[model samples]
Target: MKRALLGADDLFPTGGEAPPWPGRLVELDGSRLLVRDTPATAPGAEPALYVHGLGGSSTNWTDLAGLLAGRLEGQAIDLPGFGRSEPARRYTIAAFADRVIRWIEHSGRGPVHLFGNSLGGAISVRVAGLRPDLVRTLTLVSPALPFLDPRRSSQSRALPLLAIPRGDRLATRLLTRVTPEQMADQIIDSCFADPRRVSEMRRLEAVEEIRIRYELAHYIPAYLSSLRGLVSCFLRAYLPGAGSLWRIASRITAPTLVIGGRQDQLVDIRVAPQAARVIPDSRLLILDGVGHVAQMEVPRVVARAAVAMLDEVSRPDAERPPRPSRAVRVGVAAAKPGSAQVAPA
Candidate 1:
């Protein structure tokens, strides 16, 4: 396989606080969001919107967004309660999806390529199902969908705490006692396949980021609410017919790409193919050594796959080849959204 070609911009930031990358705040009718916009180097490139995972900000997409800048005009959003965005008055998966849809609709950038990771991935799926006309294609990386073993996930472990009376406050107080650097280290251990791979500079940056977020009075509430929303979504996804994510995935008309990390401790990698099976026009990619945040860990590879998927879907039906069945497509390595090859476990 050919290595993915990448520029310096496709790399993670090394310096602290603000990096050299360009970003701005986008204000909608009811809310404001921080967006990292990367304009295409050439004219008339397709527009793409990226969503981050639970507890993550738009910064999660910084590397991947930059990598895809040449092929797509991309915007990485910090969902409400994460990053710089304020907490939503009512936090729910539907509410979050609605806000994203509103932003795209107001910006008149409908039918854009939609990419999401973790919670954002689930939100992107919701958007694709609700407003197919607004989504050109869908790409999900470690989407926070329901998994068989909830105990394997950190989010699941925290669910019990939320059930307690005044739980959110108690959790906040406990979190405050922990320093940002310690929290950053814990995150690295949980999210990465190899924690030592993170550089000292990057660690410092993460520490600073956590420090700022920890200082915010709304931070804990936002995190707690988002957690509840995701848990609620997972419960809803298990319902029979119509209401399930399976139903939503089947309804998506846009071509789709699903990415998973083999060593993902949060969302099980085994579920990747199951996710791809529901999307009529979709393929799955599982990275051997990677964990939860594939786009962050392997930005160039994910970007290359994304570009290829987009190109394949862009072709007219008469010109395009017959798509492979979901089972076959799930089996193939680096499978095209429409190809049929058995994926290796």
Candidate 2:
């Protein structure tokens, strides 16, 4: 596959020229979801759906979606209880996937280029697996899948603990003690390899977002519930044949891109290669010095890679012949080096 190169300016666009993120509340399954529809610069581009990570809103895709505007008509959704959306009736991954499926079916916009991060990744996996007709392609960034690695940070360790009776209350109290700016700082520290690299404008935006999220009456409850749901997903020891994420991945025929950040503190980097291996028509891209949120932290890098994948698959099947049943590794990092191979257990 050909590698796409993006200019430095593409990564850091000037103010005002940044792509527009127009917000709309779309109802799916009787629940309102805040979505950002970014029109493509080119006419009649295919539709793409972006799902943000846990606690992330549609705004998280602002930069990355803009960069892909030339090739895709992008829409980023605020999952139930996040951003401007209301709390969901249920908080399971299946529940979240069902809402997305309903929206796509109702809108007659099936088989879109689907992109997801963290918790959204797991949700997208279920969608692509169960409703393969709804996903044209799949892109996952630092997906929070189950793994047996013991080298986890406190943030991850705290997730399963939220299931305890008083866990949510204790966590809420600790979070409430911090100012919004401090909360933003904490998030940046955990999600970015270099928090200082975040532009001043972006920093201000994040601080304001933190403030708004903190003010939401249902925010903490929703966050805790989602975290608990994710923990349950991780704990399920499904057999290899059925009801497993790897099994779900194998059923997906869509061309897939599994992206991982070398410095990601949440999801283990090794999961990327494993996902690529399981998904038949998949490729892996590991970005150096990036963290959990590659779309937000390194939009240009991710945009180029995504566009490259689209370009490869867009060609005639005759010209772009399918390879053997093995997954491909499509990218390498310059800032830091790590094994891109799927390591054995």
Candidate 3:
């Protein structure tokens, strides 16, 4: 694979660019998924797939995908019922992973770079573990791996609602009170260390997306069920078993990059290092002052780290540098003092 050198100017889309990438519905195994395609700028660029977190869509990857477009022909999928995709009968992590695997197979893009955020991260872990042949590199941004501490983040506070009967309905009623604009603001506030980092245009786009999704009959159910499924997975992770995500992470064969935001409120930043430790060939990056969504919060930094990993993997084994004995922390200057720390080796 040829590597494309990205200058500082290439890290973001130019001003006055159009909206997010165009998307179309793709049918694979009788299921339709909405996929947004970002064409690569460099010749011979390899394929890459992006998966969004719960309550997010393919648009979540716009900035990061655009930043890496020179080295990767990126396709970001709106997992079942999230964006424009059709709902699935099951919303389990395994089900979501299967959809991703099937898409890679159907598109003949196997062994491609795989990217995921939050819920998508867990799904990507399963895909990289179960279908190692289909993933060349795995990049997880604040992956929602099973964390024992639910109180660490405000988002986890909603987990109990999933246990209550008709919690989806309750959620729907609560959400109905808030306008799409308010909802969008709330999401931005929760996901970003500084909500002001989000451009006004992006905020409008998010509100528009929420407005459209609110009309979808399956949207709320899909979101709630997926959350319940995630919580279930977390519980299962506690049991000593081979089926756990940690075990699966240990089995991943692809070169992995685990990116975490120091101020992430969804998935605890503390779990980031542990995730890197489990993967046999993995590098860890924790960005200071970043929140749950590092890709959106700091696309340039994320792209730099991602491109570096790609370059490293493209090199011949003899020429590649040795793996770090401990996580080599980077991008900390972008945050506050002592906000992030390297996990002990």
Q: Pick the candidate with the highest TM-score.
A: 3
Candidate number of the best lDDT: 3
* lDDT by candidate, in order shown: 0.73, 0.74, 0.82
lDDT at position 159, candidate 3? 76
Per-model TM against the reference:
0.86, 0.87, 0.91
Pairs in clash, predicted candidate 2: 111-134
Which residues of candidate 3, in runs, are more than 4 Å off?
1-18, 331-345
Rank the models by TM-score, top first.
3, 2, 1
Name the TM-score of candidate 1. Answer: 0.86
- The digit string of per-residue lDDT tens for model 1 on 1-345 reads 111122243333332222415667778776677777877777778899988888888777766676676778988777887788867886777788998998899878888999988888888988999899999999999888777578767657777776888777898889878888778878877786666555565667677878888778887787778788777777778887576776787789888888888878888776677778777778777777677887766665677678777666677878865654433211213422211100000
Backbone clashes for every candidate come to 7, 1, 1
Q: What would you estimate as the lDDT of candidate 1? A: 0.73
Q: What is residue 280's positional error in candidate 1, in angstroms?
A: 0.6
The reply for model 2, stretches above 4 Å from the true place, is 1-20, 237-241, 321-345
Candidate 1 residue spans exceeding 4 A from truth:
1-20, 321-345
Model 2 TM-score (2 dp): 0.87
TM-score of 3: 0.91
Candidate 3: minimum summed lDDT over ten consecutive residues — where? 336-345
- Per-residue lDDT for 265 in model 1? 80
